[model samples]
Target chain A: MIQGISIYEILTVTTVLFFIGVYGFLTRKNLISMLISVELILNASVVNFVVINKYLYPDMLQGAVYAIFIIAVAAAETALAISIIINLYRQINSVEVKDTEVMKH
Target chain B: MDLSTFLLMRHEIVLLVVILLLIIGEVFIAESKKSSMVHLAVFLFGIHTLIGFLSIDYGSLFGGMFHTNALIQFLKNVLNIGVLILLLQSGDWLQEKIIRVNRGVEFFILLFSSLLGMYFMISAGDFLMFYLGLELSTLPVAALAAYDITKRISSESGIKLILSAALASGVSLFGISMLYATTGSIYFTEISYVITADNLTVLAFILFFTGLAFKISLVPFHFWTADVYEGAPISIASYLSVISKGAAVFILMILLFTVLKPLMHIWENMVYIIAIVTMFIGNLFALRQQNMKRFLAFSSIAQAGFILLGLITGDQLGTATVVYFLLIYIFSNLAAFGVVQAISLETGKEQMKDYEGLYRTNPNLSLIMMLALFSLAGIPPVAGFFGKFFLFTAAASKGYYLLVFLAVVNVTISLYYYLLVVRAMFLRKSDNAIPYFKSKVYMRLGLLITAIGILVIGIYSPIYDYIYELSRNLL
Candidate 1:
């Protein structure tokens, strides 16, 4: 445990954040809020990569590089999500998840 | 990399060059001449598919980040063939878009770009490359799903697809991070060397499997499929149902048989239960579907379950059967969707009730639909029967008798629903039946090729032998 901070503690925090993000994603109805929840989930993974790289495999920078790639991908994903939300809003004047169920049985 | 090593990536390079040429043509060509771009794309992809078969070099690049071999070549060529058929069947849709929205170039561009991603994904030797290629392949497909901007369902499908895809990938990335933590490497070979059946690693494996199950539209993760298929354009829907799902299954098989081989005892049980649930749920849901797209969606889900039968064996015969099934599935599913597309384009009707007495008006199209549906139901003498037979044989080889029995029951349940559509088309009579309409030359040719493929692929023994040989070398 470096400086009294253990890897277990960090992983615990990230796991909590990940589940909270999942809860928000399932409960929330707004498109933008769901996107935010997705972002939180992605960020939790990013945190996992950085913490794991620093503590366990400091000899190699591969995890750090992978984390960077994840961040870039999350950015692109967010852009696409926002554009889709805007398109949905234009169609029905609302971005609620329930409003998008026009293809129901 | 050496020059010879670079030559091994010829399929991807050719695809990249074609994409560039399409972009240049989009800018320089006048509005009226743009339809020729579709022809160019098809010609180039055909050449690409032929080249893939000819160039069979086995090698790895970037310290095992990417690998290429005869099996990968075969899979890439299969995808190229699927895409070429998609292009052929999409001519009418493309002409409509060119005349109305003027976005035809963008459609082909997005498709080829997504195909490029699949090429990288099938060849990826490491988790990082796999993740990157996955995102690259999936994002443009969301854009393509929303191609019909005026349709509310189209944009809504885009939203659901991208959001769910993001969540799945995030969960999978977390799993990858855990695997990296435990194994100390992201490359498949390195991971395989150190992987063990510990609790944490097992959990990571399940998480990763869930992500891929979403891609393959397995039971629990398949909520997005029906809606998306119903909303997206028919051409894109077929692409998603066949090409994307096939690529995912291929990569998943590779990862399971190679990187995660050590944890087979755990995954085999998980897959056994999932397969049972997936097959039952898919067929039960398909039985009630009124929309053709939704019906096909559930049917494809059941097909994914059948593919899992082969996955459970994790042997050469298993792999060969899965590949063979997917080849037959590509032709069968596309033929079904092609007929639906032609009918929908002509009449703008998508409901099963509207298809009553179709045989009376459009005998040829209805006949094709019946044959395709019969194949899908695993009737004898069609490609799907042979595909399912081989899959069950592979599973039974592994002593999975109960699972095979359950699968047989599910196949019976599925046949009822498949014949429901056939009954509606051939047996029922309606006063307002769809008129006989001739499709474009390209659509007819596309449908003809897939129809012939469906008819003859089952009787061919050499193809199965060749697939077995390819699967033997996949590892």
Candidate 2:
């Protein structure tokens, strides 16, 4: 039989993972890598949502519904984003964020 | 439903109808006559805005998932006027660029969808309703920010916006879930009743604030703003700056003053810290910007910082100040961007140096720009001054004297950069300056109306009194 850990530990771990993902996103030089890091950050939140829902307000199902919606939206967002990235790569032949930093001071 | 119920729903229904018609019209309109569809959509939307103002009775629906009090109705009208000016100014640019044609109709649809979302978000009484309304407003604007698909930077802007927004939304959702876990309900009014300075509730409030702060592009969450603003087209930037930010501020005010009042001790300190950092960082970045769009981007961010002053107040006076300031800010910022849009259309140049001796070529546009910049800098004889005055007074009344003092100093720093643009336009001379160009009648008329709004609102005090009454009804 598996013994479940405490809810506080779950929340703490999820929060830490989110901050790590945010760090990577801010520090990453490549746009695609940053996007991946963002995905991690979003996933961390989904985990927190599921955990919170499991622990509290299980009757409402609002948290679970919200998680589903977020996942669907995230998928759609990534699909559009990746295709745009591919197009940009086709034209510029590079995906490094530094190479695309032309419109700034 | 009774006549009163029907009357209460009119403003939202009108906007919803206009959005549907525009979407359907986009499908059927022939390629050659598509512009006619755009025109018709604008006409319908304008009429919808007039109807929104004509609305007097206030009501809620779907258990307060949506509402339209006098304050919200007035704001919707303000948003309509802002969008109308943006549409008029952007027409020439959109028409000239072949790549951006069909997207114009989609742009309008997405814009109204976001506006509709904002309408509900401002009046949302429950956390679930608020979250839904927020997503409705956010998702489309992210798409609109990257509407110029042909450009690499445009796509980049879209990706950045969506990614950040998703992260912010998810974090905020987690926070909301925590709130539910703590309070045993998701309704904001219920949570407000239960919430206190408890650790769980404070953490939840912080997370929620972070999400909304990203929307407003406040400091620490503002990393994405300049890049996205610089990358997107000018029209989209104008929308992002004026309409989207205005709507977010509206919801923030509502949430802080009403739903989250119990969490004040925790979030008030957070807002105080965020406000100071946002003002400082935004001003520092704006000072170094060369791209006209990026400059405005940071400037708007700093303005967002100042608006946080009202949020820190947590009172009806704070709400009134916010509405009044946003009303004035809409006129000033959009006017400044209108002049920039008009100039960029003729010359395809958007640098400050490119604007050298602009006064010599087109004195009218330059003068309009000067007034706009002055207003943005919170100078006398313009609306921005009055806006800031009310905001500062609101903050001071709450005994936030330190934030008020720092905001005043930040205002001084802001004046320097706004005047820098004026100097570039009027004092400097470039040998290769283009000859004076004629503006489209719509562009000129928009600028004239904005200038008048700035002047009249500053010189007159009645605007404040009227918005105060509206805020009283709102609360």
Candidate achieving the largest DockQ: 1
TM-score for chain B of all predictions: 0.98, 0.96
The CA lDDT at A42 in model 2 is 71
Q: Point out the worst 10-residue segment of candidate 1 chain B by lDDT.
A: B93-102
Off by over 4 Å in 1: none
Q: What tens-digit string does per-residue lDDT give for candidate 2 at B301-386?
A: 99999999988988789888999999999999999999999988888898888888889999999999999999999987778888
For model 1, chain A alone compared with the true chain A gives a TM-score of 0.95
Highest TM-score among the candidates is held by which one? 1
Count backbone overlaps in model 1. 0
Candidate 1 CAPRI level: high
Best by lDDT: 1
Q: What lDDT score is found at residue B474 in candidate 2?
A: 53
How would you encode candidate 1's per-residue C-alpha lDDT over A1-105 as one tens digit per residue? 269999999999999999999999999999999999999999999999989999999999889999999999999989988888888888899988888888875
* Interface RMSD list for the candidates: 0.8, 2.5
